[model samples]
Every structure is written in C-alpha cells, then in structure tokens.
Target: MGEWIQSIADTYKAICAGEAPWVALGNFMNAWYDYAKDQREALVSESLPALATSSLEQRRWAAFCVASVEYLCQRYGLHCPDWVYQSQYSLVEPWFHAVNPHKPQVRARLIETTPEPFTRRNIYCGNKMFANKYEFAAQAGTTSPNQAI
Candidate 1:
C-alpha cells in the first residue's frame, strides 16, 4: 500500500510538473485495474480499517493520490472500463477529498465547475450526492439532495 501510494504521489507530482499526465494516469490505472477487484474489496472489508486509523496526513495523501489519478484520467478522457467500483465506491471518495481538502467553498466551486465527464452524474460523487438534483445544487451546508455532507 505504501508503495502504491508513493507511486501515485510521484505520478501526481509528475503531472503537476507538466510531464504528460496521461502517461502517469495510464500506468496507475493499469496497476489499479490489475488488482481492482481485490482493492475494491479491501477498501470496504480490510484496508479501510488501516485507512481509517491512519493519520489525517496519511489519509490526505491517499486521497490526493486517488484524486490525482482520477482527475488526470478524466482530463485525458480515460475511463475505468473494467473496474466497476462496486464495493460501496469507497475509492471514489478520495477524488472529492483531494479536490476539496478542507475548504468547502473550493470544494463546491470545484464540484460545480467540473466538466460533464467529471461531474457527479458520471461519478455519482461516491454517493456523497444525495439526489440528482442536489448533485448540481450549490454546495451549501455540506448536505444537499444529491449529496450527503
């Protein structure tokens, strides 16, 4: 897990440095898809305990890694055609977490400004959005019809 996270962080750093985000996203996505079934299960069944117990920094890094990859994937129009993300979609949360971090205002703007392919409709906001209407609802008070705060 540490290695995977490190690899992801490195990838994000590379992307931030303007070094072909698609290449990193592709490599990371390939690794993820290789073990996605196990990872999907671990996200809910096993790894979550560790993730939950991890320091906020650790969790934050994890979230950043996930978000970076997902964002790059979307930016490059890469989709997880094989990874269904069926295990409660826990992996999806990090994308939002990475985007929002601690600022709800930015989170809201980022969520609202996100393009169609990256919007809540496509990603379901990890079920964070309560209803379809609230998905696009102005980010107010954390919880909206489309998402749960």
Candidate 2:
C-alpha cells in the first residue's frame, strides 16, 4: 500500500485503539498537508472509503471518523465520496467536540461556528478544528513542509 494509505490506516487503528478522535485527526492532518497532490488524491479516493465502511463497535467513533474524513475532503476541495453521505455515517445525536464542563456555552458556540461539513454529519466542532495545517505552520515560521511535518 502507498505511504499515504498506510498513514490513514494508522489513524484508523489509533481511533480503534481508543485514541481521541480529535487527536487522531490532528495527527492525520499534520501528515496530510505534507503529502503530494496525487498522494492526497489517493487517500481521498481509497483510504477514506475503507475507513467509512469499516465496522466498529462504537457507533459514535465510526460516525466521527466518517465526518472527519468528509470534512477534510471538503476543506481540500476534493469531491467527497458518495459513501460519506450514507445515513449510516451520520450520528443519531449531535456530538459536540468540547469539554463537558461548559455544556450550554459550548453547545451554543458550536452551533454558531461549526462548519457545514461537520454539522451535516451531526458532528459539531470548533470552526478552526480542521484548519489547514500548512498555513498554521507557515504562520509559526516553519518555512519548509518537512519542518512542519
């Protein structure tokens, strides 16, 4: 398998092994921005479908994975795969990706700022939850893609 595919598979494995969805997604995004265009395309077309279809005991995690992948695809201007839109990939109840201590305020903020890609799948997170990694790296004075990675 290609390196990018392996990277995505590793992210899936990490999620299955009980890693936080946001953490796994952050790691995946860190690597994703460094991959070549064709490699990124390969991941969008191949790895994401496999991840979306994989059976997991935790329905919420499964939904989060699908939503995250769809969100990434949309952010990068890739055509989101049809399988991502399947009803099974959407959460029955909305998931707010924030600490529980400030429930009402967090929910209100998420409702206002969560991007459409995540909201469509009933996964609500901060607006900048999946911002372009490369842009952030550049802002932090990392001149090289490899440096960011």
Candidate 3:
C-alpha cells in the first residue's frame, strides 16, 4: 500500500470527525494521474496547481473521483481500461470516505484480501537435475563409453 493509501484511512477518520475539507488539490491530482493512467499525465502535471487550493474544492474533486466514475468511463469509452476498478478507484476511494465518512446510507468499501502462504518445495535445484554422465554409464553396467557391457 502507498503512503496515500494509508493517508486515506486517516482521511476517513478526519472526515468522520466533522472536519471541513481535509482533502488537498495535490491529493486529487495524484489520484487523477493514477486514474488517467498516462493519458492525462501531462495535462494533470500542468493543470494540477490551478486546482490544488481551497479545501472545499479539493474535497469536491476527490468526491467527483468517486461520484462520476461511471460517467467518466462512458465519456472515455474504450480508451479507459478496466483498471479504474483497481488502482484508480483505490487511489480515490479514501477521498470518498473522507467526504462521506458519516454517511450511514452508504456502505464504504475497500478491498482487503489475504495472500496465499508460500511454502518452498525442494528449495534447491541440483538434486532435481539428472545424475552426472559417468554415474549414468556406471549404473547401466557399460564398461566402454560408446559400448554397452
């Protein structure tokens, strides 16, 4: 998880606490860059500062990331990959939580999964490889390298 991801948990807490507009424009821009996924990088890079100030505005931008997910997908059509459900949505979801941490009607969601445990089997390769050439010849009862005994 990213620092921003951790901060989203914090942001959720803050939003629940009734603080006004805890989100910043930089947060929106970073999330948008992730959402845009290279298609809007240069634009976000150049346009972010203009949108970065004011807590209310920042909060609104973050909310939009959540609110207009379907609309944006429709607007971009095939250009937007399915990754919006992955990283892009993830990056913005915290802001959505921040915006509506206390919304009882809405169920805030985040993906929490446990990875499968890794067990090393035969951890070394040499034992699995074929035996040496001489050992094979000796095992076959061959006295000469080219002739069978």
- Best TM-score goes to which candidate? 2
Most lDDT-accurate candidate: 2
Q: Which candidate, 2 or 3, would have the higher TM-score against the true structure?
A: 2
Candidates by TM-score, descending order: 2, 1, 3
Q: Which stretches of candidate 2 lie above 4 Å from their native place?
A: 4-10, 36-38, 47-57, 139-141, 144-149
lDDT of 3: 0.32
lDDT of 2 by residue, 28-89 (tens): 67666764445664554544334444554356666666676677777778887666677876
Candidate 2, residue 149: lDDT: 71
Candidates 1 and 3, the one with greater TM-score: 1
Q: List the residue pairs that clash in candidate 1.
A: 128-147, 128-148, 129-146, 129-147, 130-146, 130-147, 131-145, 131-146, 134-146
All-Cα superposition RMSD per candidate: 14.9, 3.9, 24.1
| Residue-wise C-alpha lDDT for candidate 3, range 1-149, written one tens digit per residue | 22332123233334444554335323333443343334432222221122233455354433333323323334445233332233222232232232344554332221121111100110111121112334456678986534642
Local distance difference test values of all predictions, in order: 0.41, 0.67, 0.32
TM-score of every candidate: 0.30, 0.73, 0.22
Ordering by lDDT = 2, 1, 3
